[model samples]
Target: MLRLPGFRVASPTTIAEAVAALAEPGARPIAGGTDLLPNLKHRLGAPTVLVQLSRLPLRDVEVRAGALCIGAGAVLADLAEHPLVRAHAPSLARAAGLVAGPTLRNLGTLGGNLHLDTRCRYVNQTPLWREALGGCLKSHGDRCHVVPGGQTCVAALSSDCAPALVALDATLTLHGPAGARTVALADYYCADGTAHTGRAAGELATEIRVPLAPGPRRETYVKWTVRKSIDFPLISIAMRFDLADDAVAAPIVAARVVVGALASTPKLVRKLDALRGQRLDDPATADAIAAQVGAQCKPLPNLPYDADYRRAVLPVHVRRGIAALVAAGENHG
Candidate 1:
């Protein structure tokens, strides 16, 4: 049986107490424990203490400053069904509903999902499995087996809420001993898989605010996984488009396309400077954009599915996302 290593759980009623607890050495913050517990059982991260976040008052979902402010501890199910989220950012709702299973969704918090760890085939294994192979770059090895002397870990992060939130122009507020600071959600990511989200050692996210886009905006979130439910996505796409008109071939006034689960950091495609204002309804245009998108992603053999298969599916996902958004926008108009 897989057993969690010896650890203590500290429940704090206030955010300051929780932050102080996490500041201790060998201490980690856990909200839903859906992802952290599994890793603990596998001996991947052996922190001596877990600072519980449920007792803190970080579970509210409300509107503030013309944006939907979501506490980090808010459960996925509630967030998915929140009236403000559904009305202002349906893509976030769609992504939240699609997370794992109904049970996990009820238990997992938005903060937990946003800060989920990166996964690699070599690292996410039993101790025995890792011992037999001398592990890999993310675990105990000197070289990355996937890249053969690659300098950095190539784990893939498959968080569903991250991409959708990024597409929505979200901002995250992190609290620690120093105080609280709000930054763009996009700024929370780093290039390294090992340090996927840029939450510092002593800091934890307290809340997120997603600004409402102007009218005539459409968004979509799509997840490609082996199973329909209770499975991590092999790849996921979250997209947003502001349309100039409801007519076919209408130009995109502004756009953001974020691809997740394919790399360490959810990748933001910003090469669309020339492509913006281009008609999104054109199949050929989408294909060309998809082709360009596919060229930028560098998939590695870190996921359960084959790397080549994941690589080949990028364009299909992009095409599908574009088609879905276009249709939805037209209907909205």
Candidate 2:
């Protein structure tokens, strides 16, 4: 049986107290434990202390200063069904709803999802299994099993909410010894799989702020997995379209497409500004955007799925996602 290493737990009632506790050496902040517990059991990390943040008052979801402010402690199930989240950021709500299963969604938090650890097929296994395979880059070995002599770990970022959040142009609020500072969700992640997030050591993410769209907006989050439940995305995609009006034929003022489960950092498809002024229902619009997404996203052999198969279906899924958004109606957000 897999067992968690021995550790002391500290439950902090205030954010400042929690930050201070997390600042100590060998300290880790734990929210839901949905992701962290499993890794702990597998001996992936063994922090000397676990600082609990459940007592802190950070689980509110409301509109503050024209932006949807979601406490990092907000439960996934709550956010999935929250009216404010649905109306302001539909894609985020959908992504949250689709994470793992109902039981996990009930336990996991928005912050936990955002701070999810990157996963690689070789790295996520038991320590004994990894030892037998001579340990991959993420497991403390010299070379990367996925890239063969590649110095960087290419473990895939499996967070379902990250792509959607990025597409919505969200920002994160983190508090540490230095005090509070805000970072763009788009810039939060790095390419290194071992440590994908740019979150500083001893920092505690307190909140996520999603700016309200100035005009009508339509957004969707789609992913393909081996199982309907409990499986990470194989080809995750999130698309957001800003429209001039809430009409099916409304011209798109701007658009953002983000692809996840491809690398440690989500891939933001570029050259999408050319998609401006096109109707969401226009076939040419989906075609052009889909083409760009496929061209830019190159799936690696980091996950269990075949890299070529995931690459082949990326554009197909992108096109289908756009079509589904149009079918769902206008101004989904």
Q: Indicate which candidate wins on lDDT.
A: 2
Tens digits of per-residue lDDT for model 1, 32-62: 9999999989988889899999989999888
For the record, the alpha-carbon RMSD of candidate 1 to the native fold, in angstroms, is 1.7
Off by over 4 Å in 1: 245-249, 329-333
Prediction 1 global C-alpha lDDT: 0.85
TM-score of 2: 0.98
Model 2 over residues 1-333: C-alpha lDDT tens digits?
Answer: 778999999999999899889888999999999999999999999899999877889999999998999999999999999999999999999999999999999989999999999999998999989999998788968889888879999999999999999999999999989999999999999989999998888999999999999988889999899899888899899999989998867999999999999989988999998887989899999999989998999999999989999999999999999999999885465
- Backbone Cα, N, C clashes tallied per candidate: 0, 0
Q: Could you give me the TM-score of model 1 versus the true structure?
A: 0.95
Error of 1 at 314 (Å): 1.1
Error of 1 at 195 (Å): 2.2
Assess each prediction's global lDDT (C-alpha) against the native.
0.85, 0.93
